[model samples]
Target chain A: MRDRIIEIIGTHGKNQGALIPVLKAVQRMNPRQYIPQEASQLVARIMGLRESEVYEVVSFYGEFSETPRAEHVIKICDSTVCRVNHHRELVDILEHTLGIRVGEASRDGKFFLEYSPCFGACDVAPALRIDDKVYGNLDRDKLEAILEAYRR
Target chain B: MKKNVALITENFHHYIPPDLAGYKHFGGFTALKKALALSEEDLIERIEDSGLRGRGGAAYPTGKKMRQSKAYQDDIKYLICNADEGEPGTFKDRDLLEQDPFGVLEGMVITAYAVGATHGILYLREEYAHLLELLQGAMAAMRREGLLGQGILGTALDFDMTIFSGAGAYICGEGTSLIESMEGRPGRPRNKPPYTKAQGLYLKPTLVSNVETFSAITAIVKHPQGVFTGYGTQKSPGTKLISLCGNVNNPGTYEVPFGLTLEEIITELGHGVAGDKGIKFVQVGGISGPLLPRACLKMPLTYEDFDAEGLSIGSGAVLVVDEDTDILDFLDAVAAFFKHESCGKCTPCREGNRQLMNILKRMREGTALPSDPENIQRIAHTMKYASFCGLGKTAPTALLSAIKYCPEEIFMRRGQ
Candidate 1:
């Protein structure tokens, strides 16, 4: 873990502005999809910054999560465009399919559902992003198919 | 019966992205070639004459920003393409970046040359992280063909660009906050006066522009001397990429001239509301922009017209809400967005958005408080005036505009 973290830091360098990218890479590397305490401390030590500074950035942005998450994070769009398109129905379907609420990870830890601001997918309203990819114009069946693929 | 003009989006549906050969075939880097031949002063002057404004919500004069960045005497200057399209209904920037990646890159290189910027950063929002591979592939092709890095087209100029991902902060869309986030800090807006032009992105002269603005710059440079100015009104020259969405038949990005009415945009371009539903109101720009009722649909989609009506063509997003949608529901979403996105840097925004959300929630829940509507206005006004940055200042625009356009909807519930 130390060697991989060191390798990530080596690529980004120990520059002042390299912290955000480094932390993001570290979070992506973790299987649980979070920046664990040890990883944050390691990043702080290698980047020549205090632990609070690292944690401050982690807590500030919506992308980073300190606690462990499911294998995939699903961010639903609850903004105006999506709301007008009845995103709540999609949210209900997501909860029913995953058997978890909006802010909870599935029982098997396959998916975590949370609300997100508009991610520029308004053209395809009622959009949700899974990890890096966005799925929009979603109906219940399409969403279930997507989750099924991720479940496997 | 005017048709949608296709300047920046001309090559959108024509070819698949990351295809360098196809992009060049569509006359991609001809602007860079044209811009390189002209002197820096000439390039800046042409931009000034073109009358292009920032496509991001601010609508600041793009030429003036470039000239200001150029005026600063600095060894290292940065040009950041603000692709943080977090504005609720604004997705035109994403479309431009995805469809015409080369055009945006060409514009950045030209602007870097004009402003004497040493390095450039494409500050892409993390939401669009899927586009990183395509953009990187396009950049790699440019580098292979001698279009990026060191000398470009065998000239004395040297400029290179890299992508910087934003970590889900809406306030970072502001120039200073963006710089702060890039410098590995919390994405919070900094105090101005030492503006980005004087000191930005590691405290050097920087030029931050929207993604669509850069695409427009490429078009302006490619066809100089009134050719680009032939479109749009006298005050607002050139077309705007309108992200038409929400309860509409065609919810997509359309590039249209400035003087067209919102009615035409909603009816002709958007094919009216979804299912032929009657229109209730339209929110031009993003969530921060004003909410215009159906009566105001006759108003032209120009900066001057919007400004005359005490509104702006913010982010060029036209959110058409049908009569089926409730005003309180819309306002609740708007309030909730600001509350969630407030960086908590200042009291007015951090607390004001909270109070606004609370009041709206109560209003939605039928909790009786006659003072809630007035209190909502009071808090919104405070946030508008006393908040630290543009986020806090413009945060209450939808709430305030809701009161102005649909007072009965807000006050009726409260029995006021």
Candidate 2:
């Protein structure tokens, strides 16, 4: 992981401007999907940025997680369009199925549910992103099918 | 009889094959080739004459912005296509990028030439990481064709572009904050005075424009025969692409002339509200935009008309709410979005939005006091005037506009 962090930092030139990309690359270095303390320290050393400064970038953006996450992440759209299109209903259904709230991960470490503000997929309202793939115009059956596939 | 001018969205209905040849076959890059022949000053002047404003809500004149960067004598100036289309309800840019990547690229290359910029960046939102592979492949094709590399199209003008994905920060849509994020920092707005055109990116002169605005430039430059100005009103000429969403029947990207009324946009373009629901109010812009009551339905969509009514054509996001929708619930969602996206940089935005969110939550739970609306208005006033940037300044727009238009609807008694 340490050597990989160095290589990622090198891939993006070792400069103050390269800090965000380096942190993003390092976070994707593991299934945990977080910038570990050691990785933050390594990024700080390579980019000549303060360790706290590195942590600031990670915490500021909602995408950068600080800890281990579930295997498959499900981000339900919570923006105005989706909300009016009954996103809350979807949230309720997901909670009922996964036995977790909007911000919680299932006990089995299989899925994480979150309220994402506008993924720019407003054309297809009531959208949700399972990992990186966005499924729009979602109904209960479609949501179940998607989760079922992910679960398998 | 005005028609939906298909300059930016002409080939939208068809699947755009992700290559330069595919784009060229659909009348793409033709404007760029013509633009390359014109001198930089002439190119800037032509766009200035067209009255094309920044499509990223502010509506600042595009040519004037490019001219500011052109005035600066920097050897390594930058051009950025602001594809960080995170504004809720504004999916027009995303559609433009997906449907016509070459049109946007052509706009960027031409804008870079006019502004004397050698390098460019497309600051795309992280959620649209799916489009990165297509954009990367398109750029490679452009490079091979010598259109993106040194001496593009056999001219001394040299320009190239790269993509930088923003990691979920709505505040990054603001120009300076976008630049700060590109520098690998937390996307926070900087105090203005040294505007980005003079000192931006790596403290170099830069030309940053919205994706739709760049796409518009391609259309504007392509038609030297005044076809661009033929559509829309005099003050606000050209077709404005609207991301028509919410309870509307045809909820999709629709390009309409600027002077079309809210009624026409909703009824004609959007095919009316879904399920035949009675229209209540419309949020013309994104979350930060003012809420227009049904009384203003006849109002024109021009910037002049919207500005006259103390509103903006912010990213052209038209969200129509039906009569069945609850105003308080909508406001609660809006408040939550602002609170969540607040960068917490300033006291007015951070503390003010938190207070606003708590009040809305209390109201939703039927535990609010009668004086809370007044309190929300007070906080909104401070955030509008005293807050740091556009996000803070415009955060209270919907709440205040709702109060102004439908006071009885929003500030209701508990359990009525």
Provide the lowest-lDDT 10-residue window in model 2 chain B. Answer: B11-20
The alpha-carbon deviation from the true structure for residue B108 of candidate 2, after best TM-score superposition, in angstroms, is: 0.6
TM-scores of chain B alone in all candidate structures, in the order given: 0.98, 0.97
Interface RMSD of 1: 0.7
Across all candidates, what is each one's fraction of true contacts kept? 0.88, 0.87
Q: Which ten residues in a row have the lowest lDDT in candidate 1 chain B?
A: B407-416
Best by DockQ: 1
lDDT of model 2 at position A38: 80
Candidate 2 residue pairs in backbone clash: none
Error in Å for residue B177 of model 1: 0.4
